[model samples]
Target: MSDVQINKTKLTYDYIIVGGGSTGSTIAGRLGEKSQNSVLLLEEGPRDKSIYIHIPVTYYKTAQGPLLKRYNYQRSAEQTPQHEATMVQAKVLGGGSSVNAMLYLRGNSSDYDDWEKAGAIGWGYHDVIKYFKKSEDNNIFHNKVHGVNGPLGVSDCAYKHNLSRVWLKACQEYGLPYNPDFNSGEQQGCGFYQVTIRNGRRSSASKAYLSNRRDNLSVETGCKVLKLIFEGNRAVAVEFIQNGKKQTAYAKKEIIISAGTFGSPHLLLLSGLGPKEDLEQYGIPVVKDLPQVGQNYQDHIEMSLVYKLKGAFSYDKYKKLQWQAVAGLQFLLFNAGPATSNIIETGAFWWSSQGKKLPDLQLFFLAGAGIEEGKDGVPGGNGCTISITQTRPESVGYIKLQSADPYQQPLIVPNYITAPNDLKTLADGAKLVQSIMSQDAFKDYVESSHVPEKPLESSEDFENFVRNEAYPGLHPCGTCKIGKDELTSVVDPELKVHGIEGLRVADASIMPNVISGNLNAVTIMIGEKAAELILNS
Candidate 1:
C-alpha cells in the first residue's frame, strides 16, 4: 500500500517537513497536533517500524544488517591508503534514531552554550533545556535533569553483561568516578548505558513523537525529494520521484528541509540555492549562490579498540544461551534483559586527553569488540571495547554533488586529520586511553590493548596508528553551517537560507561546530525549536 494519501503536488500545506526522521517526525507531529495547521512529511526510505527496530537489544543486528542502509558511503583517509572510513547512517523511516545504539543522551552543557555564542539567537542552554525536558520520559534516574512523562522514554539497559560491571570497576580502580547519570549537570563516568527503549523496544522519535498520528500526517516514503521548486525566490514546492515517476508537492506556508547534514545541502545545491561555482560545475542552474551550503563540514572522529577477553560477552557475541534466553525473556515478559542495552556501556567528556583548554574529547566503552576497520564482528572468547574520539576536531571537510540525480551518491570528502591540531588531538586522546587502560583500576580486568597494546613504544608508532585507525563519526554536522558571515554561513540564526524565502533548514547541517558528544538528541531539539520559530513567523 502507498504511504501517501494524496497525490497532487500542487496541493498547498501549512507546513512541509522534509525527511521524516527524528526531528522531522517531532516537528510534523507537533504541527499536526494543532488541528488548525496542515503538515506533510516526506521520507526517502521505507517505514522504520521493523521488528528489530523496536527491539532495543537487537539494534546491533540492525546496524550490521542489510535493512539499515540507504546510501552507500565510504571515504579513504588521505594520510593512510589502507585505513578506510567508517561512516554508517540508517536510511529507513525514523532515520538514525531507528538504527542507532539507542542511547539517550543530551550533549555536554556547553554545547548549547556554544550555539548561543555563535549567533544562534535564542538557542542558549537555558532555552534548549526546556525542549529537552519536553521530549523525554524517563523510567529511571529521575531528578532535576530528567522528565517523567515526556514522549521519548529513557531507561537504563536491561541486559547488563558481566563485562560492563568490569568496565565500571576498571573505571573505579583507574580513578574514574562512577557517575550514576550522564544526563545531569556532568557526563563523566563509567556506569550503565541509557537507551531510548520502553518495555524493551526502541522508542525512536517517530515512534514517540509521531506515535498516534500516522494517519493524520500526510507521509510519503520511498520518495526521494530532488529539490525545492522555487517561484521568484520563494519555495513553492518540492520535486521528487517515486516508483520511477516524478512528482511535485507544494507548500503554501513553507518548505522545511531536514535532510540531515548530507541530504539538506545536496538538495539545496540542486535547488540552485548553494554556491554558484559548485552548481556551475555540475551544470545545474544557480539560484541564490550561497557559498557555505556544503562547506565547513565537521564531525567527531572515533577509533575503536576491541580486545579478546577471558570469557564470552553477549552484546555482540551472538552464541551464549544466557544472552539468547535473556533477549527472548526481555521481549516476551517485562521487556528487561540483553535486548535493553543501548550498547554504549559508559561515556565521558574530558579535555583533549592532551590538556586542551576546552573539554574537546570523548570516551566510549562498549561490552563487545573486534570491529576492526569498521566491519569485523566480535570474536567469542569474551571481550569489550573502548574508543577515543576528538570531540571537536579542528579539521574540516565537505560534501559535493556528483550530479543532479537523486539516486547518485554525493562526493563525500571528509579530509580526515588534514590539520596538524586534529592529529595532535587524536594522538593525545589515544595517549589518555592508554593511561586509563593501564590504571590499576582497569589493569586487573583489562588484559591488553587490542589495537595499540604495545605501550606506544614510541611517538611515531602512536602517530602512525592514529593516522591509520581514525574514522569519521556517524555524527556529521555543519555542512549547512549556521553563522553570520556570508562567506561561511549557509542559514541565518533563524535557520532560513540567507538569500531565499519561504524555506529554511532544520537539521544537523545548521550546527556551526560539532558538539562534544553524540549529536542525535540535539538534532531533534533543533527540529522542535525550528517548527515553533516557523509557526510563529
Candidate 2:
C-alpha cells in the first residue's frame, strides 16, 4: 500500500508535487496522463486504505482517528478565553477529500471575481469556470454551467432522510428560496447537497485522480518532505524522510507545493522561504524575505444550534444495533441507504435578515444531534442539528514556525472574531438559524433545545453564546495567498513563488480569501488549472 520504496531514495521527475492531497493528486494525475513527463507526489501520511475513509458517514471517525494529524490550533486569546479549535489536517493520500463530509460545493462566483480584484489577475469566475468543468462529471445535474464528463465523480446523495425535505420546507417558510442547485453560480437557496460519492463509496481525490495510475507517476505516501533544495533563488529538488530514511527528489521543470493551507506555509518556512525575522528566530537560513509567507489567514467560523426531535424521523434511529445492521445490509447489497448519505446532505446559503451584497452565512442541516461535537454522544431519541457558519470574516490570522525541526507543529493563530463586526455577523447568523428551525414546518419535529438550552432573551445573549461555542469550520486558507506583489502575497497569478524560480504553489493555501462554502471542489480546480499552467510553461 506504500508508494515510497525504501531502496529508492533518490530520483528525478519533470514535476515534483508535494502533499498528495486533493489538489496534489489531481495535478499528478493530469501530468502523468500523457507519459511525456515524469511526476512525483510525496505525501506525509500513509496510503488511503482504511474502510472508514470510504464510508460517507464515518467522516467523524476519520477526523478523530489516526488518519488525521491534530495540531495545537489555538484561537485568539484576546477574543475567547481558553479554547483549542483543534484543526483537522488529514494525513492520508487523498487528504481532506478522503476524510471530509464529501459535500461537493463550489463557492459563489463572486469569490473568484473578488480574487481577481484583489490582485490575482486572470482568476475571475469566467476564467476559472472552465477548469471547474474540466474536473467534474456530474451525474444528475446537467446544464451549461455543469460538466457531464470529467474525472471527478459528482452525484446527488442516494438517500435522504425524510426529515431533510421538512428542513428545506422549513427554510422556505423562513423566506429563503428553494433552489435545487448550489453550484450554479447563485448560492442563495436551500437544497440537498450533491456529494463527491460514487457507487455507495467515497469518491476521494485519490479515487478520482490516482485510481488508474500511470507508469510515469511516482506516488510516495508515508514520506514527509523535509525541505527544498535551493540553488540560488531556484528550487531544484526536495529533501524528505521515508520509512526512517532520508530521500531526495529532483524536478526538471518545476516543483509545485500542494501541502494545503497549514502545511504549505509550514514547508515554505522550513525551506528558508519565509520572513527573515522568523527564519532567524528559528535559527533557519532565509532564502527569500517574503513577509507574507504565513500571513493573511482566513477561515469560516461556525456554531451549532441543536434540537431534540419529537419523532424518529432523523437518522438517530440508526443508533440502535438492529437499525445499524439493517442499514449496513442495504448498503452492502444495493449501494443505497442512509449509510450512503453524509448526514449534512441539505443546507442553505442566505444573507442576514438585514441583507448583504452576497450570501455571507451558510447553514448545514444535519439529521442528527451530537454529530458536530461527537463527544456529546448520540441522542437518546430522535434529534437534529442546525449549524451556522460565517463565510466571510474581516479578521485575519497567521501561521509561524515553532521550531527549526520539521516534525514540530507550527503556531497557527486564526485570531477568530477579532473584529467586532465579525462577531456581530455571527451572532446575527445564530439568530437566523434559530428562527429557521423554529418555523411552523418543523413544528411536528421539534422537541427541545441543547446548545442554547433555551430562547435567547436578547442580542447580547446570542453574541455571548456564539463567542463561547464557535469553532473553526476547517476551511483554513489565505496563509500563502496569491497576489501581484511579493510584499503582500506569496504566489503570483501563475501560482509561482514571488521571487523563486521553478517553484509554484497549487492549493487552498494560495487562496487570497476563503470562499463562501466547502473548499474541496475549488482546490481540485486549482490542481487542474496548475497542470494547464505547467504544461503551457
Candidate 3:
C-alpha cells in the first residue's frame, strides 16, 4: 500500500475506492492482497485513533460524539406527531462498523431471497451465504453456517449483565423459544446477541480489513470526494479536497463508491448522475439522468419502552463515582467488566399481530434507559429499556440536494409510516414487548413504566405514542438500490451503476431493501463479495 502522500499529477492506482468505510475498507484490503494490484481509499474523516473507539462499551461515546456527523431529517408531515429528527452517521475510517452497537446480525435467509426476487439477481440466500461466512470469524458455534477463520471477529458478549438473563426468561415466558444462534438460518426466538468484539475491544472493519497495512494499499484521511470524473460515460477519476487543497486521483481499472447510503447518492447527484430535472435545478449538467439515484430509502424505525427497575440492576450503576472507578480498574486490569459489553445484549425476533411468514418485529432489551436515544452516560436512576422495531418497513423515502454546493447537507425524508401498515406494525410490536415485560420472569425486577405513562390499551393510543416517540434505528439504506433496470434502480445486479462504465457501488446503498436486522454484518458481506467480483472480472 502506498502510505505516503504522492503528487496527484504522477499518481494513478489500479483501483480507487471512495469512502473508507466498511465496504470501502474491505474492498481496498482485498484488492491490495494481490501484490500486483494497487488500491487507494479516500475518507472524508480522520483516522480512527480515538481512545473510546477501541473499547466495546464506549461505543456510546464514539458512535455519536465528535466522530459522527449529525444529519437532520424530516418525517411524514401527515403523521400525527410530525416533527424533525436527527441521526448520526459515522465520519471515521471504519464508518458504521466503528460507531454501531456491534450487534453482528446477518439477517434471516428470507432477506436475501427477497433481494433476488426484487431483481437483485445472483444475490439469493444460497449464493450470498458463502460471502457472509467468508467474512466472519466465529469464536463459538463451529457449524456449517458459520466460519471459524476470517478477519472480522464474532464473539458472545464478554460480560452479559444478569438482567439480560431475566430479559431472555421473560421472552420465553411470553412464548418465544430460545435461539442458540440467530445467524444459523432461523431467527424467530430470543437470545443474547453476538457482537463484533474480541478480547473486550471493538473489532471494527478497519481493525479487521485494514490492519497491518500492505505496501500495495493506501488510505487518505480527511479527503472529501466531491464528484466522479467521467470520460464519456466511463468513470476514470475522482476529484476531492484533502487538507485544504483540491486533488484528483486517477484509476487505471475501476472506481468504486462505497460511501454509504446517504453519502453515495449525494456524491452521485453532485456529479450529474441523477435525474436531469434535479440536476438542472441545481445548475449542474446532467449525465445519466438516472432518476432513481437517490430514491427508495428504507430504515428500521424503533421506539423504546423505558421502565424504572426496583433495584440497581441496570448499567446505570456505573453512573456513581465509585462504581465508575471500579469499572475502569476492572477493564484496565483484566478486560472484564460492564465496560466489555455493548449493554444492549439480549434481543428477539417475532411475528407481529398480523402474522407473516417471517418475523416482522425485532426487539432489543437494553440494560439501560435512554441510552440509544442520545443521552449522556446513564440516566438518573436504575432503569432498563426495551426497543421495538418493524423489521421490513414498506415506507420508502428519497434524498434531494439542498443546493449545488458540495459541502451542503442533503434533504433526507425517510417518509416513515407513510404506509399505514408500517405504522400498525410498529405499534403492534410495542404492545407485544409490553406484554413480555408483564410476564412472571420480570416480576421481581418490575417497576412502573417511564415512557408510556399509562397502559397502551387502545390502538389509537399506541399509534399516538409511536408517532410522538419513534426514532430511527440508525440503519438507513437503499438510497442507491440495485435492481435490473435504470427505471427502478440505481445499480445492476453485478453492483455496477446503471449506464455507467468502470464505476460500481458496494455498500448498504446498493441493498435493494433493508435487511431484517442490523446492517453492519451484511454490509461487510457485500464488501467481501464485491472484492471477489472485481478480482474475477
Per-residue lDDT tens digits for candidate 1, residues 167-219, read: 66766776667778777867665566677887777888888877785444687
lDDT of 3 at 401: 94
**Candidate 2 to truth, TM:** 0.96
In candidate 3, position 192 carries an lDDT of: 90
Per-residue CA lDDT of model 3 for 1-537, tens digit only, reads 353336747568889999988899888888888888888999999889988888888766775688888888987864545545788889999998887899999888888998999999999999998888888889997777898788999999989999999999989998999998888889999999999998899999999999977888888899988998889999999999998998888898999999989999999999999999999999988879999998999999988888888889988888789998999999999999988999889999999877688999999998876577454322348889888889999999999998989999989998988888888889998889899999998989867888887578998888888888787888989989989999999999889999999999999999988999999999899999999999999
Please estimate how well model 1 matches the true structure, expressed as its whole-model Cα lDDT: 0.75
List TM-scores for all candidates, in order: 0.92, 0.96, 0.97
User: Which lDDT tens digits does candidate 2 get at residues 1-537?
Assistant: 123233455577788999999999999999888677888899999999999899887775786788888877777754555845576778899999998889999899999999999999989999999998889889887677798778888999889888889999999998999988999878988898999988778989999999996778888898988999999999999999999988788888899999989899999999999899999998998999999999999988888888877778788888889998999999899878888988898999988654578888999998887676433533457788888888788889899999999999899988898887788888888888888888999888788786678877698898888788888788889988999999999999999999999999999999999888999999999999999999989
Which stretches of candidate 3 lie above 4 Å from their native place? 1-8, 78-81, 375-380
**Candidate 3 accuracy as lDDT:** 0.88
The Cα error of candidate 1 at residue 479, in Å, is 1.1
Ranking by lDDT: 3, 2, 1
Which residue runs of candidate 2 sit more than 4 Å off their true CA positions? 1-9, 83-85, 353-355, 373-375
Error of model 3, residue 334, in angstroms: 1.4
lDDT of each: 0.75, 0.87, 0.88
Tell me how far the alpha carbon of residue 520 in candidate 2 is from the true structure, in angstroms, after superposition. 0.6
Candidate 1 versus the native: TM-score? 0.92
